[model samples]
Target: MGDEQIDAAALQSWLRAFARSVAEHKATLTALDAEIGDADHGANMDRGMTAVVAELDATEPGTTPAALLKKAGMTLVRTVGGASGPLYGTLFLRMAPAAGTADSVDAGTFAKALGAGVEGVVARGKAELEDKTMIDALTPAVEALEAGLAAGDSLQEALRAASAAADAGRDATIPLVARKGRASYLGERSIGHQDPGATSAALLVAAAASTLGVVVGG
Candidate 1:
């Protein structure tokens, strides 16, 4: 497969879509959190993405993927407080190196870049899948991306599969006991609650699908 073409306008549109989705689902996310967290995951992400969208609009970084991601990472780091800020910031920061020069990336390149981002998150948070953290969602999403690429899928197909995998991973978190982060403090009490990080990670993958014009399926 060849490198998928994405332009500055597409990237900008994706960011805007992300911000809108987070805002629209704010209550749902916070409600999921009220069961296990501080009930601020949605609010925090909404605020952070709002800032990111503003920066994207004001700066108009064009098709420089690296610069755009870097700016987004910095914005998240500065605006989003908590473990999420650092973790997500690191994910984008790590991805910048791979996405830096190209206006578009092929499925294989995107998969590799996303894998790097997931590794950064793992290293920063010291968390793993089934630990009731974002790793649950992100790991499976990246894996699915790899699988899709290996199968010679188009970038859109890969993104759609990745998004579906992420959603499933997010749902799976509900049955696992927390072993990291604030939720871990609850021990077995965390078993029935959804992981806020996983929820947000799923949102990220979903945003990717929407931006890339992938028709996601259940």
Candidate 2:
């Protein structure tokens, strides 16, 4: 079996779906954040994604995956505020060069890029598992993607596995005590609430499954 390639259109669709998901769940994210940190995750992400879409619309990076992802990363870094801006921005930034200039990217390449992106986030945030942060969801999702690939799954199947793992990681955050970021400030108070960042990370994974995987699967 060979790597599953996704074209520029597929990448665009993935970004669009993620933006839409963030917008649609803005209130929910904010409410979740309010439980342990500042109640602005939703607003920040919504604004950031809106800006990213607008940037993409105006620039239209065309078929170059590296160009598109780099532009997206820069836009996020410039437009988005808070920890998400840097973390998500770093994700795309690291992924951009990793994706190279291919007209389309294979599943293995995509997973490698995603892994690099997660590493970027970890470097920037200095977060670890059970930290009640986005890393909680992202780490498991990446692991699932790798496991799926090792099992000879296609890109769609791998993404599906990743999404499920991300969801599970998000759910698992509910009972965890905060150990990083703003959530850590709450101490025992953060135990019962789900981490907003983890929830949003799951949304991003789900977006990939809904858009990228669906396109590949179809």
Candidate 3:
């Protein structure tokens, strides 16, 4: 059988759903940022995702998943503010090549793309686990997703596991002293504050579970 070209629509839906999730949690993200970092995580991500959706809507559809993700990455880098724009932008940009030339991406391919994207964030931000950054959420989610898939879990189940891991990673950020970004400036004061980047990253994973999980059905 051939690749399911319809998966392109599912990927598109995933991006749009992520935008909506960002909007829904904007206030919460802003509050988290206000606690330790620049108070613009929510606003910046919201703007970035809005631009992503608009760009996708306006531009002709891409021939492959890689092209779509690349376009989205460019929009984010061009539109968003703060350190998040570049970090998040690099994430998608890196994922583009990893997403491959297939018109439709399968569950394994999706996971691989996410892994590549997270690696980009880690490299760009120079962050690791417990750094109180998005990597905190992203790393665990990818690990959990890959683990779940390897264990023979369906895509929906794997995504659910990934979402749970991301949420836990986000929560774990609290009580840790910041080791990166503006939050590090606070030193000991950064302790006890939830990381805004991790919070939004959790949302990103959850959005994938709800959107892509439904469309692909593993």
The candidate that achieves the highest TM-score relative to the unseen native structure:
2
Query: For candidate 2, lDDT tens digit of each residue in 1-218?
Result: 32667777778888999999999999999999988999999999999999988877876445587778887888888887789899999999999888978788888888899999999999999999998899999999999998898889877888998999999999999999999888888899999999999999999999999877564333
Candidates sorted on lDDT, descending: 2, 3, 1
**Candidate 1 positional error at 187, Å:** 0.2
Give the lDDT of residue 65 in candidate 3: 82
Each prediction's Cα lDDT score? 0.83, 0.89, 0.87
Candidate 3 structure, TM-score to reference: 0.94
- Clash count (model 3, backbone only): 0
Model 2, runs deviating above 4 Å: 61-63, 215-218
Best-to-worst ranking by TM-score: 2, 3, 1
Q: How displaced is residue 69 in candidate 1, in Å?
A: 0.5
TM-score of each: 0.93, 0.95, 0.94
Span of ten consecutive residues with least summed lDDT in model 2: 209-218
lDDT of 3: 0.87
User: Runs in model 3 with CA error above 4 Å?
Assistant: 1-6, 215-218
Give residue 134's error in model 1 in angstroms: 0.8
